[model samples]
Target chain A: MEILALFGDFTVRTVAIGAALVGAVAGVLGSFALLRQQSLLGDTLSHAALPGICLGFLIAGSRRLEPILAGALVTGAAAALLVLLLTRTTRIKSDAALGVSLSLFFAFGTVLLTYVQRHAGAAQAGLDAFLFGQAAALVPRDLVVLAVVGGGSLLVVALGWKELKITTFDADFARSLGRPVVLIEFLLTVLIALAVVIGLQLVGVILMVALVIAPAAAARQWARRLEGMVVLAAVFGATSGVVGALVSASIRGLSTGPVIVLVASAIVVASLLLAPERGALWQLAHAFAQRRSLRAHRVLVDLYRLAQDHDDLDYASEQGMLDTYFGRRTGHVLRRLERRGLVSRAHHMPEEGTHWVLTVDGRQQARELIRPFGERDTTLDGATQ
Target chain B: MTGLQGWLDQPGVTIVLVGALVGVAASLLGAFLVLRRESMLSDAISHSVLIGIVLAYLITGALDTPLHVVGAALAGLLTVWLTDVLVRSRRVKSDAAIGLVFPALFAVAVLLINVYARDVHLDTDAVLLGEIGFAWLDVVRVGPLEVARSLVTMLVITLVNLAFVVFLYKELKLATFDGMLATALGFRPGLVGYALLALVSVTAVGAFDAVGAILFVAFVIVPPTAAYLVTDRLWRMLVLGCVVAVGSSIGGYALAVAYDVSIGGAMASATGAFLLLALIVGKHGIVARALRRRAPRPPPVVHVPEAGGAP
Candidate 1:
């Protein structure tokens, strides 16, 4: 099969690959994103890209990737600058500054998009596609561009790993050590913007933020170390891309971006439910299993009473009475009791059936579960069951 | 017919009324949006609701007036729900969760619009603009008002939203200020949150046709932001937001008419201008107080004594 034909060669696939690569790289970087508590900055900058993309398209007059990306970079940087300005100039905190900048730039972007749509009709055809992306229109060239940008994003992260980690965990400390805190921060913003632009062609303006944040979030549940989290995030991001692409291929008229989000959501849900110690389901199951074992130990203690009370500690003595006392499930409970050697059936009592009794070890096991319930002396006065 | 005739009968008044109405509604919700620190939620919900509209069309095969609105509500709710799920379960932060959910949903909506919506009477332009001008072109009679059905829809939504905020004021305030305290009091922050989300959904639906989804962010944020400059109390904030919104609406329409520009854009620009003005020139404006107070002068005699000693 032709390599292209086998892949169902289309812009959609190419663009989908671009989207996946963008997601993977961003997810890795986003470990730092989440750690810094600036997860929403992705959303802010992505929206901030709108006006730039519009301006780029307005001047450049084509869907060519490079100019639009440059336009996005300028706007994203401006938005970040405004946020920084807001934080420094006022008593308002970082979140407020972020909120203010996010809304203002996005509003400007909307105005730009609407204005261009109405006025620059011939020059600005297909502009709205950038707003939400036109992944299906991806070409080989677009894929190459994404790969380069995506690779560059990875390189930036790897090269600045020590500096990035230092700044993320403690900017003050890094600054105290006379590190280039401002420069590193600016560099991080540019790299994030680069990730946003790489994703723009496929994931579009609104959802590209999601691509950056989701995998990192899921990876966090599984890893204690930051490096481990970043690696896991990249893996999850790549996997989401693959599954999303396959689903899009299998289904006609299905959009790639939403499917990708759904796939990432699945990964998150799986991690939340299944990851050891932290997962909700695992903890719930562990607690339930512990309770059931405790109850089983209690039932064995009741058998200890039946056999040890009679001093036969054998199957034939008072076996019918023990069965009646233990209820209908007594036979089943008795089997477990015998397995533990808390009870046994004697050869002489084969006709008599099973006898329930506690071995010395079994008696010890019974005491362990009952110990936390308080001693018999403490329980007698309360008279509570 | 009655609704259209009424609207056309007062075309100039209608534009201002529509603009003001959009402003008021957007600003009302904008307060909670700003307070909850989800001001950007407005932007997210408005853009993402296109997914709902397209999905509605796909499911029902008609972008009939009410269905389109309903679809928007559904889509808006879906965006919120997905955001919540991502943030809570995936350990994804709220902003990223919001970012992830809507774009994907919006992309799906746009994709549907691209492939299937062509013959189905769904154009992207109409989706964005929401036929603000055409609202007068079609109408339905309601009791005595003879209002444009769009206005009627918005009015009903506005009233319901007002009622919701009024009744749930205490709960919303408590939750907004201190969610843990609200939970400790057994006031059910979850229920309050649901109510707020529901209000956002309804407002999005109501505003969808009149202002379009993208512009909805302006209304949802601008007024509240401006209001924040003027007041610290929640009720006061809400009042101020509504006032700013209404003022911007009328002012924007007049400006648009004067300049022959897009009414929605003008309205949003006006609101933005008001926010900037409030930030700079309001009572607490940085420039205002800095200019009012001056710093003390340094001692000039000390320098002369040092010079004499050197001589």
Candidate 2:
């Protein structure tokens, strides 16, 4: 009831809805950005948008969102293009280019912003708020801008999935198919700028980078196909947004962006460790179990070989001999094999140590295993002979 | 008498010195970072160092303590370590891992700041955009002369970084250009890289109160990057990067004074101005390359002596 009561607040509802839209759109676009290895571009573009925001404000002579966002998109595209140009033409590597563009454009913007603050009198208010955005500033009217841009970008992605997918996974292949690789790249960069600017008012620039990256990275762990990844990422992003919005609203006066970023990062952390097949923890466990079974299987085969060498079906090999043969302790491996009914422990004499002998079932299993190696390495007989 | 004392006494002198010192320190380490293609690491380290500063402050209940820089160094190393873990796990790519780790640390730091903000005067805005205008207000007496504490701090950091660069020049050059060879030769390039980033972290923390994190990142990356475009030699790059930084500091201060804007911000922007200049004039620059491309290509000539063997 308390949670429901909180959501009933108009401001909270609007902010939550807006944040969800921002998350979903960014998730879809960020997948391609990640695959392109241009994840840092989001950071560059977002920071680079500051000057455009200032210029737009100056031109419009108002605190209107449309011109400001327009200006942001323009500079964002320019920064992206500049990065591409530096990488293509000069020896400037992408990371250096990114750092270069990010600092320069942000520096330019900061300079412009301070300049605006001094000259524009009181009219130039709330601009500094963009540095760390106030999510509570989200009004009902602004959600329309988010929805139109977010929905339009989503629509474009749906309609051009084939071209986008080909270009994303393999640009040269797409170029071979006569698709305009350069144009598609430009379009995607623009879409990314769109995704970044959509939530600039709610999340700010620094946190926007995290939003674009975290959800998609988490989705990568679970999804096998591009479509599935896109959908899953969107879901993850939306969930982070809504949860963060609620949590921040519940705790009075806390900004929502960092909270949202923490939630998204939390999701990524969980997905990395706990996802079924691709998860680190799951793979670690799988590898551990596989190694254990492999050791046990090796011990089983060694016993069978010993029996065959001695020309006795029930030939016993001392554990010490087996240990030296394997060059390690085999007590645990022998015990495990025995537990599996693959081997049996015996004593030849009181003065001698415990010995291992293959059981009937173990011999049969060993024969099954040995048969594969024999078949696969049949050429080995010819080579040896 | 407009001698050194009078000039130094002006607020402008302190601002430029503070900016220039921070710039020199950052550019020294940033050259290697740029060459290794880990330039973005500065961005990540600067953000994550906030946690260290906040933790140190929380423990000590004061700002500008030596523990803050130590804590920041540890935090910087922690970010690199965590990013390495994520990459090694094969769960996430390196960039994503970096993106994930730093933001998580930054978010936690911000939340801590917000939660404990009432008890302390640690304003986030001030931390984000430092007040270099007030640098001369708080002065520490060094002998008969009183100096701004930030200037002394930046001076020490600059010297430390300079010593690191000078002492380990060969090691850094080898590691930056050929990491595997360095590792094979038992140089432990990875350790050197971490030590380098740790100092970067310490410098970023030290510079935080003067230029803030964003501008610190600017100083760390931009000047060296500008120098990279202009020079082929490593030593030239180091000197050129410092020159770019000092120039930006002086020029930006003048611009800031002229327009009445943020002095630090203008200084950072001035690096871009110099980079743009480098782009047009450097040997490997855009203009030179374009001019060459526009010129006619020469015919491929075959040497008579080697032609028979080649055929």
Candidate 3:
């Protein structure tokens, strides 16, 4: 009931929906950026938007969303283009080029922001919020602007999905197939700039990269295909946005952007540890299971060799002898085999330890293992000799 | 001589001197970083060092102290270590690994500032774009001489960085160009790399209170990058980067005064301008490429060549 009431609140609803839209768009677009290894490009674009936001206010002379977003788009695109130009024309690599553009543009923006604050009256009060977003300041109209821009970019991504995939995975092949790879890449850059601009008011400049990257990175761990990755990223992004907004709204003095970033980072941490196939935890468990099975197989083969050396097929092998063959793991393996009824352990004197003998089932299982490597089985027999 | 001495005595002069010192120190380290292709680590260290600053302040009850520098350096090393751990886990690529570590650390710092140090002067805005104009106000008296605190701090850092680079020039060059060879020769390139980063972190912390983190990055990366474009020799690149850094400091200050804008921002912009200039006129620049393309290519080998070939 409390949660529903919170959602029913107008400011909360607007901020929540707006954040969700921003997250979903950033996530979807971020998949390509992450896969292309342009994760820091999002960082560059978000930082670069500060000047544009200030420029937007300067041109429009008001705090309206449309002109501000337009200004942001212009400058953001310019920053991206400048990064490209620097790398292409100079000896600077992409990382240094990106760092140069990001800091320079942001410093320019900070200068502009300070200028506006000193001269532009109290109306410029909320401009500083772009540094660290003020989601509570989000209005219904702001949501409309976010949805239009964010939704439009999503639609464009969906339409250009094939071109983007081909170009991202193999640009030369795309060119050979006559697919205008450069133009597509430029368009994709524009789309990413648009995503960054839309999210600026919700997530702010500093933390916006987290929103763009964390969800996509998390989703990459779980999803096998690009399509699945994109969808999962969007879902993770929206969930973070909505949850972060609700928590921030309920709490006093907690800012929205950091909370949203922290939540997304949490998702990434969870995914890294828990996701199947690729997660750290799953890999560790898989390795452990493989080791266990290899150990069991080694014990069974050892037993089969012992039976071959003795006159009787069921001759018991002392645990002490097996320990010499298999190390300290011998007792554990024999006990496991006995539990499975593959072998039986006979208790002798406690000082002498136990004796183990293979059952009929164990002999049959060992024979099956040997048949696959029948010719190679001679190697094992020779090693024993 | 009196007039020049008076000009040198002004607070503005102190600010510029401090800025130049910071520029020199950052670019010195940045040249090696750019050569190594680890320029982004500077960005990572700058951001993550915030946690160090806050933690240092929290522990020492003072924002500006040697402990703060130590804390920041440790945090910078932590950022690199965390990035390495994430990459080694093979769960994420190096770029994403970098993206993950710094922001999380930065967010934690921001939150700590918000919750614990709200009453203090540690504003996040100040952290992002420091007021270098006011740097001279914080003067310290030492043995009958008064000096701007930032200027003294930056000078010490600059000298330390210069000494390190001078002493390790051969090892750093070998390690940067070919780590395998450096290691095979028993130089321990990895240790040199870590030491370089440690100095970078200290330089960043020294400059942070004056120029801010992002602008510090501009000083660290942009000048070195511009110098790299202008020259091929490492020694020349180092000297050229320092010149660019100092030039931008003076030029950016003049622009800031003329326009009444943020001085640090203007300085960063000036660095960007220098980079743009280098991109156009440097040996590998677009203009040179265009000129090479348009130069009359020896009028394509004519039928005379074809006749000789036939013979």
Candidate 4:
């Protein structure tokens, strides 16, 4: 009932819905950005948007969201183009290009921000909130803008899904298919700029890249197909935004953007560790299983070799010798094999302790395991002889 | 000489000197980073070091101690380590790995600041765009002399960086060009790479208080990249990068004074402006290429083979 009442509150509804819209849009667009290896482009664009925001405020002389976003879009696009131009025209690689643009544009924005703060009146009071966003300041009008931009970007993605996919995965092939590869790339860049602009109000400039990247990255871990990735990313993004907003609202002094980013990051960490197939934990488990099976196979082969050398059906190898062969793991492996009826342990004199011999089934399994290494086995036999 | 000494004694002079020292130290290590294609790692380190600073402050209960620097350096290393772990998983590409790790750590730092240090003046804005103009106010006495604390720290860091580069020149060069060969020769290129980043993190921490994180990245990457375009030799690149860093510092200060803007921001913008100029007019610049194309080609040699004709 408390949660329902909180959701019904006008201010909370606006902030929550606004954050969710930004999150979903950023996530959807971020999938393409991540796939293209332009994950840091979001960082560059967000930082690049600061000067534009300042410029917008300077020109409009107000804190209106429209002019601010328009300015942000222009500068964000310019920054992206600048990065591309630098990398292409000069010897500078992409990483250096990105770092240069990110810092330079942000620094320029800082200068502009300081200038605004000193020169402008109290009307520009909340302008600095764009640095580390104040989502609590969101009004219903902001949500309308978010809806238009978010819906428009999503529509563009849906319309150009094929072109974007081919262009992203294989640009040369896209070119061979006579697709307008350059045009498609430009469109994608513009879309990314739009996404960054939409997100600036909620996630802030500094933490906006996290909103664009973390959700998509987390989703990528769980999904195989592009469609699935996109859907999952959108869901994850929306969930983080809503949850982060609620938590921030409930908490006394927490800011919303960092909280949102942290929530998204939490999702990413969880997905990386716990997602089904590509998760790190899954990979570790798979490797562990493979290692165990390989070790068991090795033990079986050793037992079979001992039985062959003696040419005795019930010949038993000393536990001491097996211990030397398998190191400290000999007892564990032999016990497991005995349980499986692949090997039988014989109780010997008190001084001799334990011994093991492979059953007929174990000998057959060992031969089958070595069958894949047929050529190598003859060389091993020669060496042994 | 007396007039120059009087100007030198002013606080502005110390600010510019401190900025220049940061520039020199950052670019010195930055040259290697640019060549190694890990320039963005500097970006990652500068941002994530906030956690280290906050942690150090929390533990030591003071913000000004050397422990902050050490903590930041360790956090920077941790950032690299975490990124490496993510990359090794093969689930995340390196760029995405970088994007993933820093924000998480940075957000944590921000949250901590909001919760615990609300009353303290540890403004996040200050961390982003540090006020180098106020750097002169914090003075420390060394013997009978009073020097700007940031300047002293930067000077020490610059010397340490200079020593590191000077001593490990051959090893770093070999490791950078061919890690396998370096390892075959027992140079342990991996260890050298880590040591270089350690120094970079320390340099970042030292510069962060004076120039802020964004400008620190500009200092670390832009000058070295500009130098890279203008030169072919690593040693020359290092020298040119240092020269560019210092020039940008002075130029940035002049611009800041003229515009009455943030000094650190102006400094970083100056670095960007330098990079743009180098990109246009350097040996391998676009303008140079265009000019070369426009220049009349030498007439095809119509050598009169008099001796051959006679034969």
lDDT of each model, Cα atoms only?
0.71, 0.87, 0.87, 0.88
| Model 2 residue pairs with clashes | none
User: For residue B270, what is the lDDT in candidate 3?
Assistant: 92
Q: Which pairs clash in the backbone of model 1?
A: A207-B103, A210-B100, A315-A355, A342-A357, B26-B219
List candidate 3 stretches off by more than 4 Å: A1-5, A346-353, A370-385, B1-9, B297-311
Best by DockQ: 4
Misplaced by over 4 Å in model 4 are A1-5, A295-367, A373-385, B1-9, B296-311
Output the better candidate (1/4) by lDDT.
4
List the lowest-lDDT window of 10 residues for candidate 2 chain B.
B302-311
Model 3 residue B149 CA deviation (Å) reads: 0.9
- Better-scoring candidate (TM-score), 2 or 3: 3
Two-chain DockQ for each candidate model: 0.28, 0.71, 0.68, 0.74
All candidates: TM-score of chain A: 0.81, 0.87, 0.93, 0.89
TM-score of chain B of 2: 0.95
Q: Sort the predicted structures by lDDT, highest score first.
A: 4, 3, 2, 1
Candidate 2 ranges beyond 4 A from true positions: A1-4, A123-125, A302-359, A373-385, B1-5, B118-121, B298-302, B306-311
The TM-score values for the models, in the order shown, are 0.81, 0.91, 0.94, 0.90
